[model samples]
Target: MKIDLFITCLNDALFPRTGVAMTRLLRRLGHEVRFNDAQTCCGQMHFNTGYQKEALGLIRKFVADFRDAEAVVAPSGSCVAFVRDLYPKAAEWAGDEELLREVRLIGERTWELSEFLIKVLGVEDVGASYPHRVTYHPTCHAARLLRVGDAPLRLLRNVRGLHLVELPAGDQCCGFGGTFSVKNPETSTAMLADKVHNVLSTGAEVCTAGDNSCLMHIGGGLARLQSGTGVVHLAEILASVETVNPAAVVEPARFSAEGLA
Candidate 1:
């Protein structure tokens, strides 16, 4: 099947390797992956920040970009969640029946990376091998919004030489709600402190999550504390093979709040 990648704005700008790794993983599984340069943000930031009117334009653009694809796969759970859960409401609020129909059609085909890999592709093991102790942080959208329960963990479990450990308070938000981190700095920092503590407690060398946004937030705090823990996206881990080590698959750069901002 021909799959269109809806590389979210954050992944496009901040974490380009995540998108590349996702495409590599899909192609390795024998699926043709296409990237539409016309694709832009899914309007998740605007919609979450109470700018619905401005978000409508992006929502329409997203539909136009991937409307023809047999399947639309995104690496970011939050962006996919916005398209699947909010676009229909945005269309209704605009009173555009045509847009609403288009939104429903496109939203139905949009799937989070793990969801598509397990449910549609029906493959738990992508023939990945990563010799490391890894702990997963279930991002809010992937856990709560997408409800992709155990899909990511199942894939991780199948990786060769991968030790998957349960994260304490794995379901808690990493305090990176896009604008939420900016508007309420103190509260965000406090929550981030707790998340960092939990990640350190895992005793894992690497921390992995479905969303880079959360990884950015959690990874940034870990960096500040001078922790040895590294953060990687799930796609990057799953894309690893015996021929290509996970470390060499993507850049070894650690995320920082300065870079993200």
Candidate 2:
């Protein structure tokens, strides 16, 4: 199956390797993936902050970017969720009839990576290998908005030598609400503290999550105080193998696969 890749703005700037790993994993599963130069932000931040007008411009850009693809795939649940759920609302708020139609049309085409893999491809095993004991953190976007269910676990369970560990209260939000983190640092850190504690208690080497935003926050807090468990994007884990470690796929430790336990 042919699919267009939406390397979200966050992933593009912070964790480009996660995007690359996504492509590698998809291709290894025998899917033809395409990337568009015009692809840009899904404008999740602007919409969430009540900047509906500004977000409308992004909605139009997102639609224009991926509207013609056979299918659209993004390694980000947050961005994909915004595109799928909020774009039309933004359009409506702007009182643009044509924009609403366009937003809805594009939103229908966007899919979070895991959702596209399990729902559209119907395959759990992508024939990837990884030797590690890892826990999966169900990000708010992928869990609640995308409601990807056990698609990630279903796929991770099939990886060779990959031990899936349970993260206590793993489904709880990591408190990284994008702009919410910056605006409410103390609150964000307080919330992230619980998430890190849960991760540490898991005894797993690494915690993998769908949203890079959450992982970034979780990983940063875990690193600042030197928490043992590290954070990694789910796409990285899915794309990882013994020979090609997702750890090496990243660098500089900012978005790097460090503390990926």
Candidate 3:
């Protein structure tokens, strides 16, 4: 299968390894993965923040960029949800019937990483091995919007040597709604506090989620409190092979943020 990697803005900027891991994992599974440099933001931020006009432009660009892709897979569930669930609505808001038709066609072919692997590819246990105690957090967009129930958990469960613990109150939001965290700091903080406490209670060394944005929010709180619980993306965990220690998989210094510039 030829898959086009739609590295979300967060993954492209702050979590390049996630994209790299996804690409490697897919290629290991015998799929050809391609990256289009012409790709840009899915306009999730703009559309969710009332900048529909700006978002509309990006949506059109997204359609133009990936319309011919055999299949589009993104590691970020939130961004994928925005593309599959919200793109048609944005097109409707513009009253562009042709855009709406294109959006629907593209949306159907696009999928989040876990779903693409499990649902589209029909394969779990991509031969990944990660020896670590971890818990999975179901991000809001992936859970509530995309309803990718148990797909990520299923993948995690199959990882060799990985101890997958059930996260307490795992479905609760991590308090990062992109702009929501910035606009409602106090509320987001309180919600994050509850999330952090639940994560700590699990005694898992790492918290994993499909969305890097949520992990970034949870990781910040965990780090500030010196909780020692690191957050990693599902792709990174799934891409781990037996030779590589899980601890060394995600090194902040290895991938420079300056590369996003």
Candidate 4:
């Protein structure tokens, strides 16, 4: 099966290595992957931040990028959730009927990384091998918006020498609501502190999630408190194999900002 990666704007501009990692994971599993360079923002930031006009163009850009592909996959759940769950609303709000029609069609085909792995790919064990005690923080976008529902957990359970620790309040958000951290730092910090506390309680060396945004938030809290735990994207884990150590797969240096840029 040939898959087209959306490589969301964030990943394209900042974490491009994630796109590389994602493609490699698919190829390692014996599938063809293509990175359609035409892809851009999914209109998520604009739509979520109430910039309807800016979002419309991005919506169309996303549609054109993967309209002909077998499946459109993205590493960030927030972007997929925005394209899948929020695009039509943003399109309709733009009062452009034709655009809204196109948006609806695109929404039907997009999948969050985990969803694509478990549902479209029909396999959990991506032949990935990561030796570490890992726990997952279910991001609000992937967990609530996409309703990913244990797809990630089930996949992690099958890995070799991998101890999957259940994070306390696995359903809780890590308090990284895009611009929420900036608008309300105190509340964000408080919630993130609690999230870090929960992550550390597991004694896992790394805390991971489907959405890099949440892991960034929780990971920062861990780092600030000098908790020694770190954050990693789920795609990195799924893409890991025995020869390729997933735990050592660090996000590129350019993506070191913890999701603010």
- TM-score of each model, paired residue for residue: 0.93, 0.92, 0.94, 0.91
lDDT agreement with native, every candidate: 0.87, 0.80, 0.87, 0.77
Q: Roughly what TM-score does model 1 have, to 2 decimal places?
A: 0.93
Worst 10 residues of 3 by lDDT: 252-261
- Write one digit per residue (lDDT tens) for candidate 2, span 47-123: 78877678777778777877788899888888888887877778778888998898788777788888888888888
**lDDT, residue 69, model 1:** 86
Model 4, 111-188: lDDT tens per residue? 888888888878988777888889888888888889999999888988777888999987776777989898988998
Clashes (candidate 4): 0
Weakest 10 consecutive residues of candidate 4 by summed lDDT: 252-261
Candidate 3 per-residue C-alpha lDDT over 1-261 given as tens digits, one digit per residue, 9 for 90 to 100: 989889877777678888888887998899888888778889988988889999998999999999899999999888999998999999898999999999999999999999999999999888888888999999998999889999998999999989999989888888988899999999999999999999999999899999989988999998899887888899988888964443333544323323323
State how far residue 138 of model 3 sits from its true place (Å): 0.3
Tell me the TM-score of model 4: 0.91
lDDT of predicted model 1? 0.87
Number of the top TM-score candidate: 3
Instruction: Count clashing pairs, candidate 1.
Output: 0
Candidate 2, lDDT over the whole model: 0.80
Worst 10-residue lDDT window for candidate 1 reads 252-261
